[model samples]
Target: MRAFVLLCLLLPAFGQYEEMWGDKDYLWDTPGFTTTKPKHKACLYEKESCGCCLMKKQTHRMEAFFNLTHREMKKDLMLTKMYIDDMRASRSAFSFALDKNDSTECLGPFSDDAGIVFRHEFLNLGNNYNPMTGIFVAPRAGVYSFSYTISSDMKRAACAHLQVNGEIVSEIHGQDGQDSVDSDSVVKAIKLKAEDRVDVILPKGCIICSDKKFSNTFTGFLLYATV
Candidate 1:
């Protein structure tokens, strides 16, 4: 498979090999030299054998092959470097939870829709997710995986909406009047382009519970890059 790929890449160049490198005899004497030419094996197969040829065509072919191989290797190296640089610039991922270093509490039963800011960060390698506004902006085009958990007061609705660019993609809801902890979760994989916004929305009259144990959480990662 590897050889096939290289052959595909070099076929065009190989077709013009003789034009790029002229057919010159390697064993020929200089024009000014009068020395007697040494005898070399005159085999039937000029190319397939190691026998020294009268014109030494194999020697010239070997030299031209080395030159072409070097050029192809250099071109491949440059392309690999370009791809690595692009990947470094485009990487993005983040994981965060609500209310780190704080006791049990309920956040937001706000009058208007609000973004949930997760204060506890487990991993924010790319720093794409903003803790202040609870928003993640994609760095490049790719499929992304996101998982969020909602824990809220038993008396208030435990709900949250996964919004991408102001449009809701998924939701988790727990109705009021529960005797135990009201918790819900949603996991989704979505395709996004560069600069797309993602966030969890806490609507009016909704709350999320959090504590030192981190009952509510939000996480996202770049699943795979795309064109």
Candidate 2:
């Protein structure tokens, strides 16, 4: 019946049909096991390998926010260039004169905050000597407009006073003389904080200094702001 089903599939349930070809070179090149399932292999994110590590992590977070906004804009432009170089050295006009016995000194040693000093003796107006001595530390409380002078071309000029920690807020005894611009000894509208100590006394000797004024003026004081 079809040769008895091909001799019952070449026999061999424990029998043989020429001993199953006697090994046939061990089934020559054998490799056959199929159940139908292995087919994954996917990974291609594109753009040259996983998108170059996500564009280098978004370019390092945009270069760390542009290096912290360029270090706070360079410290606010160096405190506005030292407040515009102290207002261009106080307007700048340029002046100096004094010499009779000739004397000069400028002190703001209370611990200074915003002090300025400018002394020039042409020839010792009176000679007693006390040209200018200041001590202003306050730079944050309120009110502050202190001025002083003591000139002498010889018309009538001498006596100028001021104090802060000591109290005597203002004064100007011997009036009128040399006159650069001190009809009343400029010490207007004053108030302060942050340290507080403003003094400007010019016993009597037409104090003159112009280049505007504010190269630290010798300790008179400037830079007023900040609550």
Candidate 3:
């Protein structure tokens, strides 16, 4: 009688500490984990009950350990991949001039604002700038540097505006009535988001004097990436 009493007491204690699904326990106070109260541990009625319970306890412990370790490893791998992808992000820089040859071209005194489509490519590292559109669409979110030079014929006005997303950011203007060309430039650093558009605009009444010497030009580069 004493041995049976001890087994009953010890089995309940073992279940409370070792089992994932326990009766009337803090983890399973609701009916979701269990449907009925346990009748008996069956150690006395069945020959293999105690052994099976012990084996189940060991198996549960191993499965829990393995699941936790696997989850931690997967989280670590995802973070490492994000870091590597950021390191390999593309670098952007482009420089262009108004004319490809020494011959002068009177590039505009339009009725409306005109975009300067560059004719010469000095450097284009990432192909982010489109010569056809006279626009530089940022590939990565970051601070960037933009510069422009406007050189105009003696009788015409030399002027250009730097615009981001159709909003004017800066301008370069110089004009001379004498028989000589005039020029001006402005450099600016601004933060931008990916796919943001940047361009040079020539006002309706201004003109740019262009030649092989890159007298009229626009340039830009990525200072750093923010995203």
Candidate 4:
């Protein structure tokens, strides 16, 4: 009877062990559990590699966009600079006229007859003409067109010479024998170097009359730059 009781107890313990580790594919089996750990590690490595590739692609795209933007900005800046330079290079013109009364005369009979000073300024580009000195100093080397007018009062005569660097390039003369006033004008084109001086001069024993109507005038403009 004791033997039969011992045999029953041992039989229950053996059945429990077999149930715990019967199939190799079960989660409770030790060999199968260790194989799952290697598969988990491989999956993690693949995910990390994919993340690194995506990051590199994003960095490359950003770099390309920045380079293209930089090139466009540089081109725009160069164009703007060129336009500014062109505007600065093209500046040369002046115009002036007699601004006093009809009785005013730029008279000259003295030994040193410099010129008549036209004190009025209609337009003086480059600020090269001086009303105070009666001289227009060339600001750049270029071909220039100059025009001048002279008016004479009743029973009077007037004459003037347009001088460039102390040499006469043109002249204007007017005389009034009748009761009406008389006027004369002249236009001329000349090439000039930078710093060349130009002015209108009344010769010895010559007279010019002007009124509030600015009939007597001087004008000049650069056609194009030579240098």
Candidate 5:
């Protein structure tokens, strides 16, 4: 009975020490990582069970990294494409003189090497029925708008017609010995493909000046496009 009593007393003392040790050290060190909550950490235990905390943190970090990387990559690609397009449209303004009875025409394979003379594709503009003419062709595909004016200081009758693709598109005329410039007008904005054609057609009595070079002619019918 004495031995039994001594054994019970020793068991109580051991239990007390074990509880005290757990509270002081084992609770924090038993799992190889500190169990004490970080003061700055959110209540992760309230939102996620401890068993799942590590997996959730890893997944969230990976997703954030991927989103940042993808956005930067897209911005780089758009900038590169914009640079290439700007280089492709590098173009120069082109101009040429038109003659009173000369027909300027467009025939194939335009060159950007300068000194451009459009080849005549039709003979009707030079026909005797049409004494004055001018024409221009698009050097590249783009939006285009045109303005035209037919003028005369001489007292003679004239008629001017602007045509796109063989159709009469705009016209201005002075008849019965009138000396004046045609009212200025603009063509509807056109979206032309490369090599599209435009022409000016004038009847035999378009402009009249004593100087043979300026007599019964068309003047200042200009066509151009955004390069």
Candidate 6:
């Protein structure tokens, strides 16, 4: 009986020791239990969230860059268009001359004649010069160079004036007495506004002679556009 009681006491002590240091006491080693630290899990979640935010920031930055580039490109395109338009406006030019060959059929010697319109087109670029009206209408505000020539028949003297907007700028006169042909030419530069008129005028009693060789000629060209 005594030996039986001693064995029972030893068995209870062994059971107590097992309960204090059993597998169940170690939660990490238990089935279905996580070994990850809470701080470590939180750090991983934060890192993943930050990565997503970084990607979004990069996407926004790229979009902004492209938008800026597109705006700049549009501005440049507008500027290019403006430049092309300016170049076209600056290309105004014209030249014309009389084609009358017979002195009897020549234009002029009229009462208050505004000058004979050349009625001929040698180089009417931009069509600014009107052959019928004998006038050049400035296409834009710019400096222009005008040149004209007048020829007189033998024993006859002819005089003409280059006029801008009805104001005289220069004049040409030719006189010959010995049965010889005489010619006079004049060149002048003037600043003009758009629609300003330029023409040659034959004062009363003035006569000009020309032949198929276009002895009486008028020419003008845009030096540079001011507008």
Best lDDT goes to which candidate? 1
Worst 10 residues of 3 by lDDT: 22-31
* Whole-model lDDT per candidate: 0.78, 0.41, 0.77, 0.72, 0.42, 0.72
Off by over 4 Å in 2: 1-48, 60-64, 78-84, 87-98, 102-119, 122-227
Per-residue lDDT for 28-62 in model 5, tens only? 23445545566445334223343244333333444
lDDT (tens digit, per residue) of candidate 4 on 41-71:
4422343344343333333444555677799
The sequence of per-residue lDDT tens digits that candidate 3 reaches over residues 1-227 is: 45445545555444534546343223233435443445464422343355554454544555666687799999999999988786566688999987666688787789999998885899987899999899999998999999988887657668889999999999876655654777888999999999999999999888887777778788999998895
lDDT of 5: 0.42
TM-score of each: 0.74, 0.26, 0.62, 0.63, 0.39, 0.72
TM-score of 3: 0.62
Q: What would the per-residue lDDT of candidate 1 be over residues 1-227, giving only the tens digit for each residue?
A: 45435544564545545565443443234355333433353232234332344223333445688888899999999999999998887778898998765667887889998999987889897899999999999988999999999886557779999999999999887978875778888899999998999999998889887877788899999989999
Cα lDDT, model 6, residue 201: 92
Candidate 6 residue-wise lDDT at 200 = 91
Question: How well is each residue in 128-222 modelled by candidate 2, as lDDT tens digits?
Answer: 22346334455345444444544333344444466667666666554555453333444355665646665554543333223322211222333
For candidate 6, which ten residues in a row score worst on lDDT? 20-29
Clashing pairs in 4: none
What are the candidates' C-alpha RMSDs? 8.4, 24.7, 9.1, 22.4, 19.4, 22.5
Compute the lDDT of residue 26 as modeled in candidate 5. Answer: 17
Clashing pairs in 3: none
Candidate 2 lDDT for residue 83? 80
Model 5 residue pairs with clashes: 207-216, 207-217
Best of the two (3, 5) by TM-score: 3
